[model samples]
Target chain A: MMTFLVRRLAIILPTLVFVSFIIFGLQQLLPGDPALAMAGEERDPDAIAHIRKTLRLDEPIAMRYAYWMAGVVQGDLGISLRIQKPVGELVLQKLPVTLQLAAMAMLVALLIGIPMGMLSAVKNGSAWDYGANVIALWGLSTPNFWLGIMMILLFSVELGWLPASGYVPPAEGLGANLAAMVMPAFVLGNAIAAVMMRHTRSAMLQVLSSDYVRTARAKGLYERAVIGKHAWRNASIPVITLGALEFGQLLSGAVLTEQVFSIPGFGKLIVDAVFNRDYAVVQGVVLCTASAYILLNFLADIAYMLVNPRLRS
Target chain B: MTALLEVEDLRTSFKVESGRFQAVDGIDLRLEAGRTLGVVGESGCGKSVTALSIMGLVASPPGEVAAAKIRFEGRDLLALSADAMRDLRGDRLAMIFQEPMTSLNPAFTVGDQIAEAIQRHRGLDRAAAWARAVEMLRRVHIPAAEARAHDYPHKLSGGMRQRVMIAMALALDPKLLIADEPTTALDVTVQAQILDLLRRLRAESGMAILIITHDLGVIAELADDVTVMYAGKVVERAPVEALFEAPQHPYTIGLLGSIPRLEREQARLDAIEGVVPNPLSPPAGCRFHPRCPFAEARCREAEPGLGPVGPSHFAACWRTPLP
Candidate 1:
């Protein structure tokens, strides 16, 4: 297991390097110049030249890349010219907020999706099966942003139950933070729940028909024990993979859902950075999301070993 | 003595997209305690379905099983509630199936699976069940049962896995064990070993065994009584020696002929010609007429019911007293 972990880490390190390279390289290709963006309306040539030299825009691309990477490696993500703040500090501010939202969304997804999937599979060919599938279709098809808007209108405008838009830090109060974050989290969650439902349903259907399931039945197990204990254990393997990948996507898929809710998270930060041509903040956020995806995949492999003894070898 | 199990007019049908078809057509089976009854047939002849139907493990809706009476220890199984049936199963009745490699749950250790059954029916605590599982494993001749109990299903070979399956099924000391082609997936040597293990276990437990297989050789070795089926109907049934010595049904003769023997020299191996009739649309008259070489005019006009051909033998053939 240690050897496997070492091997996976070896693969992850280079992937992160490649991802950082892409982020930095893409940021370099953006049309707006940092020096020009920093300059005011009464732009002087010498002032611009001095700013360019200072920012190393006049240096070789390789030299500039090396400089950028050195700072990134030392936990410096340069500075967002628009906000005149360190990009690393901006990312840190938004990370926890987004992480909390993503976690809540995933929690809602898992709570609803897995059981529904198992129920659907066990009650296959019944009305309940079709009903769950129909609901899943709606969840999958409806854009989360539109769903977020509708939820806001119902829960906030009509019912006056939740805050319409904006976020509260957990430090203020976890309940209040949850109240503020709930709608957007659900809007994000329901769509992912649909995907989880489909994956879990199919996985369960396959497992339910397996030879071991037949053996389980022959053992005189109650239908519930057969489905829950024996079948679900095998069925959940694929769902685990889906959950990790979905969580990784949730970190980035939060973009539109985040936008609609006015939650100050990575989505809003990145959007503002892009519009303001704040390349450093965009690079930092994208780099972080990519690393998360790689890390999630790595964690998923470990989870597979833990859950399926067949893979432990 | 009263029979351990009495299955009468046990019919099973499967509703498929094409149409409904009878898989086990009005079959009857009787087994006495401390005896083995072998149900032998080619694939698609409903032998496995018969076993499943008896065990109440057949999937519903697509599959349906009905019988006039399926009495186990004088209790009519068909009259029992679903829960009552479940309580009986894996307790008074246990089953092992073909493809032992796939039959054991891969997600759990072999020990956990066996222990689970013990705990479910025996009311044993976790540690006691675990100890019983290990003991069961050892009884099945699995070497190093203590260590092997910790190994997952995949860690064992096909034969070892079948042994594990037998261990699990017999953990509760079920009165009747229905083994559906249990050794079908093992190699020849392993097959013999499993058969030997089963015979030994039967001698030890004095449990009635309902061994389903397509191999007459297997029936010869392990069975006291044998029922031969063809195209979803029992064609012949008799004590093992009588069936082999005076096989009355043509299909039974065909089945016995198909077995390659070192003693019986032939230029070419004799194989029963023609495939099994499509289950969806079996023939109007005798189901085996299309495949039976000695099929006569009366054979195609009407299906023959089981008739006494000898002192203790019955056959379902119009020309059973073959010339």
Candidate 2:
């Protein structure tokens, strides 16, 4: 296990470097010049030149990449051209909000999805199974942003039960934070839940039909015990893999959801940076999201070993 | 003495897309205390279904099991409530399946699986159940019973896994053990070893055994009484020696003849012609008429029921004496 972890970490370093290079190249290729965006409609060429020189935008692409890579190694993520502040500091400020939102969304997805999926599998052709399938289909088809808007209109505008848009940190009264987060989380979580439910149902259906489950039943175990004790653990392996992939997606793909809810998360920060031609902030956020994706996959491998002892060797 | 298990006119059918298919049709079985009853048949001839029906393990909707009477220890098993049947299973009645690789739960340790049965039926605590699991493993002749108990099914060989399954089934000391092709998936040596273990266990516990298999050699080796089935119906039943020495039904004679004999220098082994008919649409009269060499026009026109041929022997055929 120790050797496995060491090898995984070694692979992660090169992947992160490759990801950083891609993020830097993509940011550099964006249409708008960062120097001009910072200058903000200034007519003077001399002023634009001075801004470009200060930001080191005048250097060759390779030189600029080397400088950026060097700064990344030294824990300096460069300065945001629009805000004139360290990109690292900006990301640090917004990272918690995104993390909290993604975590809450995942929690909601799992709590509802797994049970619904199991029920669908157990009661295969029953009304509950049909109903869950329909709901899953709807959730999968509906865009998160559109769902967020609909939820806001229904729960916030019509019912006046939750705040329409915004965020509140958990430190400032748990109720208010949860109230502010509910709609956005639901919107983001619904699609993930649908995917989870479908994957879990298929996995469970396959496991339930296996000969071991028949043996369990032959042992005189109740249907509940057979499903829960014998079948659930084996079925959960695929679901865990799905969950890790969904979580990585949530962290990066929450841009439209964060936009819809007016949450000041990393997704929103990256979006604003794109419009403002803040290359450093864009590169920083991309690097962070990419690292998170890699880390989540690594954690999933560990979880697989824990769930299936056969895989330990 | 009262029989440990007595099943009469037991019929099991499945409702598939094509139509209703009878898997086990009008079968009768009896097992006396401490004795072995071998049910021999070709594949798809209801050998396993009869065992499952007795255990009430057949799934409904797709499959249904009905019988005139299924008495176990003087109680009507078919009339027991689902919960009552559950209590009987793994406690009063246990079963071991054919495929050991697929039968034992891969996620759990061999000890834990056996211990679960002990805990469920015997009401033993975890530690005591664990110890009993080791004891059961030892009884099955598995080496390093203590350490092997902690190993999962995947870590064990096919023979060892089957032994673990036997340990689990016997952990609660059920009065009746239904072994459905228990040694079919095992190697020849392992099959002999498993049969020996079962024989020893039965002698020790005085528990009745219902051994289902296609191998006549197995039946001859382990069974006191033998039942021969052809296409979901029992065609002949007699003592082991009578069935082998004076087989009645053509199906039974064919089955015996098919076994390769070392004494005979035959160019080829005798094989029963044709396959077991599809249960979905079996022959209108006799299920095995198409495959039977002695099948006549009357045999093809009407099904035959069991009739006395000799002492404690029965045969189902149009012509018992064969002219």
Candidate 3:
């Protein structure tokens, strides 16, 4: 197992390096002058040139990439050109918020979706199953941006139940921050849960028909035990993979949701950086998001090994 | 000996787009303690369905135990509530399925799965259950039983996994064990071993067994009595020796003739002429009429009821020759 972990880590390092190189190259390719943008429309053309040189924008792509790679290895992600803060610090400030939201949203989605999925599978052709299908269909069909708006309008504006916008760190109080974060989390997580529940239900349905489940029933196990103990565990590897992918997606794609709910997380941070042509912060966020995606996929593979003995080999 | 289990007019069906299709038609079977009844039929002949119906595990709706009276230990098994059925299963009755390779849950250790049955049905605590699981593993001749108990189903060979399945099924010393083609998935050598293990377990525990299979060879080796079914209905049933020696039903005769025998010199092995009739629209009167060479006008017009054709033997046919 240790050998396996070392091998996975070895593979992950080269993969991350490749991703960072690609992101660095692509950000440079985009038609944007960060120095000029930061200096604003009133700035003199000569001043823009001096700022660009200071930021090393005049360097060849290869030299710039090599420098950025070195800085990454040395834990210096460079300063945000617009904010005048360390890119790492800017990311760190927003990273925890995204994690917290994604974590809470996943918890909510799983806690609700898994059981609902199980119920749907067990009930199969019943009204309850049909209802779950309908909800999931809506979830799959509706765009996240539109859903976020509807949730805000319903919960914050009309119901006045949750805060319409803004974020509070858990340091203020865990409950207070969670209360503020719940709306956006719900918006993002519900969309994810719909996909998850469909996968969970199908996986469970497939496993339930397996011969092992029959053996469990023949052994006189209660229906719940047969479904929960035998069917669910075997069904979980797929659901876990789906969940991990969703977690990665939620981390980066909750921009519209965060904007609607007015929370300052990585999603909003990246969006702001892109608009202001803050190349350093943009590169930092893209690199972080891509790394998270690749890492989560690796974690999902490991989780499959842990959850199902059949996959351990 | 008083019968340990009795199934009367046992019928089970599945609903399809066309209509309800009977998988197990009106049939009766009786078993006594310490005996094996081999239910023989080709695939889709409803042998597994009958077994599942007996266990109350038939996937309802598209599958249902439409009509049957299953009596185990003088209690009406089919009439029992779901909760009561749950209690009876694994405690009084257990089942080993076809494809031992697929019958054990792949995610759990074999020991944990066995212990789950022990803990649920026998009420043994975890520690005791684990000990018993290892003991049962040994009973089934799984080498290194103690270490292998922690291994997952995928870690075991097909033969060993089937042994684990048997150990789990027999853990609570069930009164009856339904083995649905337990040896069908195994190679010849492994199949022989599994059969031997089952016979020994039955002898030592005195449990009645219902062995569902298409292999007449298995029936000859392991069964005391055999029921030959075709198209959801029993065509022949008798003591194994009697059925093999003086097979009365034409379907049985065809089946016996089709199988290659070492003792018989043959120009060509006889193959049954046609497939088993579709269950959805089975041939009227006798379902096997379409394939039976001896089938007559009367046989095609009227169904034959099972009746005594020899001492302790029964056959469903219109043209039985008298002694």
lDDT of 1: 0.90
Query: Top model by TM-score, which number?
Result: 1
lDDT of 2 by residue, A1-313 (tens): 6677678878999999889888988777789787777666665789899988887888999999999889988989999888889989998899888888999899989987999899999888789999999999998999988999999899989999999999889899999999998888888888889999999899999998898988887888877889998999899999999999999988874899998999989888988888888888889888988999999999998888777878765
Ten residues in sequence with the least summed lDDT for candidate 3 chain A: A1-10
| TM-score for candidate 2 (chain B) | 0.98
Provide the global lDDT of candidate 3 against the true structure: 0.87
- Candidate 2 DockQ vs. native: 0.75
Fnat of candidate 3: 0.97
lDDT of 1 by residue, A201-306 (tens): 9999999999999988888888888998899988888999999989998786377888898899988888888877787788888988888899899989898888
Per-candidate DockQ vs. reference? 0.83, 0.75, 0.88
> How big an interface RMSD has model 2?
1.0
For lDDT, candidate 1 versus 2, the one ahead is 1
In model 3, which regions exceed 4 Å deviation? none
Per-residue lDDT, model 3, residue B285, is 87
| DockQ winner | 3
Which pairs of residues collide in model 3? A166-A262
Model 3, residue B48: distance off in Å is: 1.0
Share of reference contacts kept by candidate 2: 0.62
Segments in model 2 whose C-alpha atoms lie over 4 Å from true places: none
lDDT of each prediction vs. the true structure?
Answer: 0.90, 0.89, 0.87
